[model samples]
Target: MMVLLISTSIMFSCKEKANVLKESIEADIIIYGGTSAAISAAVEAKRSGKSVIVVSPDKHLGGLTSGGLGWTDTGDKSVIGGLAREFYHRVYKYYNTDEAWQWQPKEEYGNTGQGTPAMDGENRTMWIFEPHVAEKVFEDLVKEDSIRVDRDEWLDRENGVVLEGGNIKSFSTLSGKTYSGKIFLDATYEGDLMAAAGVSYHVGREGKDVYGEEWNGVQTGVLHHKHWFESDISPYVVPGDPSSGLLPRVSAENPGEKHSGDDKIQAYCFRMCMTDHEPNRVPFPKPDGYDPMQYELMARVFDTGRKDWFQKFDAIPNHKTDTNNHGPFSSDNIGMNYDYPEASYERRKEIIKEHEQYQKGLLWFVANDPRVPKDIQLKMQKWGLAKDEFTDNGNWPHQIYVREARRMVGEFVMTENELLKKRKTPNPIGLGSYTMDSHNVQRYIKPDGFVQNEGDIGVETNGPYTISYGSLVPKKNECKNLLVPVCVSSSHIAFGSIRMEPVFMILGQSAAAAAVLAINENTTVQNVDYNKLKEVLVAKGQIVE
Candidate 1:
């Protein structure tokens, strides 16, 4: 009888352990992402007297900001406020100290930025910085707030999100860890959580008629930036021989009609942080699949006597650069990454690996290939990957420049009309003043049979324009307790302006504030009082105007 009782007690204890393991992690707010917006949202939520947890796929905290996009894209600096501005102030404080400038003197690194001073002493903000500095800042922000973050946790897109009466009850990661929250924030660049939650979203470019705006769809002729080929370059492998087939990286498909939409997204590339400081530089490693023929198109571009190869090696601090895609055949891996937005995690990893290989091979080809111009080759050989950046990722940027991705079709769709000041934005939550920029989408054979790049649009906005609060929340019927800050509800052209990192941080804080207000009032995110939200935002140092 005693032996039978011991067996029963052991069975009950095992059952209790299983039940405890199955219990979900509960919080007042849950944020999914590790971007700048995610960190800002988590911090703001914690400050609002709510328990918040950040489930991050990335091991590192800040997305592109710390991942080598050190050169901040600030259109109008005064419009930036709240925690976003505070972040820059923190950067300023770090740079103000003598120890911050290790490799270069403070006086040597001039205050040159995008039409403004990089380090604004009057405003106490530093726009340009190094990768490690930005990461430290983000880490400190969350650490000070005591917010919980679970790193390297990927969302199970297939069956992760659980909805009960149009509200997200909980979501599970691939590791079988579930989190239940009163409100959720999808701060990812790809909008994985939003899409998994059955929220409405558009993947690629939309027709001009869909948004009633120019520069929305397939722009075959409208090349704004210097990314297009200047001189005529043949797409054929054997120069002008059509039967020789097309060279690599050149698409053969029809680039669609102008102003008409098809499923195509802008190119993606790694914003490499390179340095000429020999002691702190690691020579660019040749990728495993080093194919010189892959960059034959670039060789042709260099053959055209184009010497502006170093135009976009923008300097940040300590002799390091936020090297971006510059010329026609530079870093932007055109005609790729179309299906990356909605692809599965495994497929996305493959895509990211391909991008990394392509970029690394491009660097090798430019530096070592005999086909490249001697001047450009010699200059490229001088620069190498910064040894201090992305230590775990082989000195490469941890985050890829996912310029555009799945955009949610939510309560209000901001179009170029709003950015151009033709239509006024209502219920302003933040401000964006950057140009409506889109990178080259396709590199295809023109109708005349010459190689030309398409879908690079760069239309300037009408100064600082207000971003609507409705853009962050989904429609009333789709989901009730979710807000998206990174992939907000905006048309392609409008999102081009709103997708800036600082603006993302601004929207993140606003979204968290709205989430807290909704939780307190026992209401949906769509039902949050705009007046109360705006008041709270203003009180918290957010520039609503």
Candidate 2:
């Protein structure tokens, strides 16, 4: 929360020792993220014998892998080679020993999206795992690589540093640390470093016309799942009443263009960590600013004898589950984070608090309310947070599942067609394959007083799609020495697939590998000889198919 102010009388240059007005540290490569990608890139840099340091905003790294997305969304497993594949193997090793499963039986936690033991052992590639386990794997990589890591240091983007010719001379952080490196990589989900480096990035969803993407903007009536109520859905603006007033949080304005897109982005939420064991369970506390009216749809669903209230808890290792929003008014904090991608830190903090309250309140209403269905209440009441996980933060996970965010408009913008396997790029740097999934953008009331959700759409993009190198690097003129891995240049639908934790790791490694090559050769990141880069990547097991 404290920003170290920079002083006057600073003296420095790229080669000379910089007594930074703020604070100073010099390295060959400086990475600005705690994500798996950041770790991968830093490791790659170290393996190449480069001096590197990671200044992560998070105390813990691994992004979603540590965040709560234990069920990995991998496309073609074979395409998930190199560091991405190593990460999964590490998870398997964690579960290899019997002691890893203290809560649940080993057989129960087996077959977690990996290949089965028998029946020809299905030729699998992608790997899924537990949240803490993923964090451990990331930590192991840091330890094995002997990489220098500094946590909780946010970048001072506005007046951090600038380039004289084209390369990034240096950058500053809020924690009185100025990082000067020959090459820099922005591996954060928010693309903060990229934004600070003056690279162009888009915050909201772009129209289909803007990117020629079929799946771009505000999708209103397009249903992607079978969670909607079977009976007549009310749109009466009020619960049970034909006309009382618009329900709390329901948008009054119409979001036009069902097929095309808009500037509004999809929602985000923390994947709640819940356990069924009573010894480890902590009852859901009613969050401050709790509003029952916001969860009226949930009540309606429960009143109709709905037994599918817990459909979102995709069971993870032990007896724990990675819980996300299953249907209407679940954990996906619908319509509340429309401005989070580009919001200021204060504004973003407020949004996070609001989301935390909404999610916490939702759980409380379900667990303690008399209005909830008996069977659903009984089941929900059994679950609480695990005792052994996230010990520092009351067992609740620290990272929020930032689904999507500010994407750089780099040298090349990956589009839906590429992700859908419709087109091929000559400069393919990595591969990603996952369904184009977006959470609800807004909640609206129908004419019949029932709720109508907007923006939740899942389109399956078949095959291991090609990801362009330009997706990671900005146009040579924008910032030659800078690279972005998490929020790389890509269309909304395309980014949905590329935004996975594994792919970020792959791209992170690739970005740093390219950076080291660029540093060794006096050329822009654009001019790193692909053959030489590919050699190092292949040696590292990175699949650039």
Candidate 3:
């Protein structure tokens, strides 16, 4: 009987170790994001000497950081510090070796590098590379640390269980894998985990009235650029035939009258990676269900003798280009993404496929159509998809350019005052320097019977501005273990600047520091001492300024 009792005790002890109690596998911190911020946060959490786990919905990490926005949008490189600086330094390293410039001449590679400071030698940053290269860097982070990583483990927002009495007990994923951590970080771009935990969040553009933001919500009359000049332009489909109605994609409405805003997110598109070198290029394949009629408006713009249409795809290094929507009726599919923020998973898939088709079709239209000027077509012909990138996803990019979406409405809502370089918050965790940029949200048919665009607001950030710490914290009543880095609490206009990848990493490092500090104090992430947080951030070489 004594021997039997001892055996039972041993069995229970083994089982307990196998299934580490909520506090065992729970780690000191848990981050829900697959974006750059998420990875940086995880890396920082480990470096800060805390066990961490990354539960990401995305199969591939680095969001847009590794997606396609390869040309970093670095305003003042001096302000970049911590993991943000390290990321660029890695990019510099990727390009320093002669093997990196396989397609172009060593000298023609322009050692000067993408209009930024030299990122050469061991302390370099290979800032420009294929999406796969960026993913490799993120992979290196996990390999470097014995940190736990669960990919495609989407937080079961509703009914996933975030036990909160201002502290998270455990949150379950769709896989039924429950993660219990002392401190949680919602580093996701969508803030899904935070929202599911009953945290307050905003969808679409807040009206100018709510935030008193000049660039918030609907701006029907503000025309930033003229890529589609219907003044002398013909229609995209067929010119001068109202009986044929408008193009398939062109909306025939007068957008909206509100000055502030409604719940409409900005237009989204894929960032195509193109190589000018033919050997490296995979010519734009004719997308299935391709239609030339949809691009009739584009052809009409070309007919008007527009030369600046090609300027949108800004040139980058190694014979590559960072494509951006330049003028009116550019690459962005305006007004069509109104339901995306609250869209169901399947519906979001449909939206992404539609965007892919639109982008692919646009490339085909430009590549094969006779309407495109010969010289311009020739220039475009030199470029094609990077064959090495997005290998499993049919040469199409896995991550869509979700420029802005589902910003959290948390303890501190960063408004235009913060973005326009006006007010400073005491709980600042990071700084954003990008402009308040939002692409055209809606397209409308004018009274003149021509299409007009609205909602493309671009107000540059005057200087570096602090991102509030409250932005990361969920309401004290909601789950308190979480720290939001990507979808931090902010007005739509303000999030644009804070949306940069470098800024995300900076925020990620700061967020991890805060999360670990919370675990040590056995308090909510909100109650972390700001002075200590700043000290750790600065000591870690993070430019909190």
- Candidate achieving the largest TM-score: 1
Estimate the lDDT of model 3.
0.76
Superior candidate under lDDT, 1 versus 3: 1
Off by over 4 Å in 2: 1-22, 110-126, 227-231, 235-237, 240-243, 446-450
Number of backbone-clashing residue pairs for each candidate, in the order shown = 0, 13, 18
If both were scored by lDDT, which would come out higher, candidate 2 or candidate 3?
2
* Residues 1-545 of candidate 1: C-alpha lDDT, one tens digit per residue: 00101111122463464322343688899999999999999999998899999999999999999988988998999999999999999999999999998989999997788877899899999999999999999999988988889999999899989999999999999876788889999999999999999999987889999979988999988878899999999989899999999899999998888989888888999999999999899999999979998999899988889888899999999999999999899889997799999888888899999999999999999999998888889989999999888899899999999998999999998899988889889999989999999999999898889999998999989699999999999998999999999899998878888999999999999999999999999999999999999999999999988
- In the range 1-545, model 3's lDDT, one tens digit per residue, is 00101111122463463432221246668788899999999999898788888888999989997888876776666677888888777766766678777667556755443446344444455555557768888998888876678898877767876565766677887765677777888887777777777778888888888877777777877866553344644333455567766776667655677576677788888877776766667889898999887787777777777777677565556676667677665678776677776676678889888888888899888888999999888878888887667888876788888888788887789988877767767677777777777777776666666676777777877777878888878777776777888888888878877888888899899989998888788787778899999998989888876
By descending lDDT, how would the candidates be arranged?
1, 2, 3
TM-score quality measure for candidate 2: 0.91
The candidate scoring highest on lDDT is 1
- lDDT of model 3, residue 83: 88
In model 1, which regions exceed 4 Å deviation?
1-23
| Candidates 1 and 2, the one with greater TM-score | 1
Write model 2 residue lDDT over 139-234, tens digit each, in one string: 999999988899999887778876768778888777667888888999988888888878898877777788677777877667887534455555
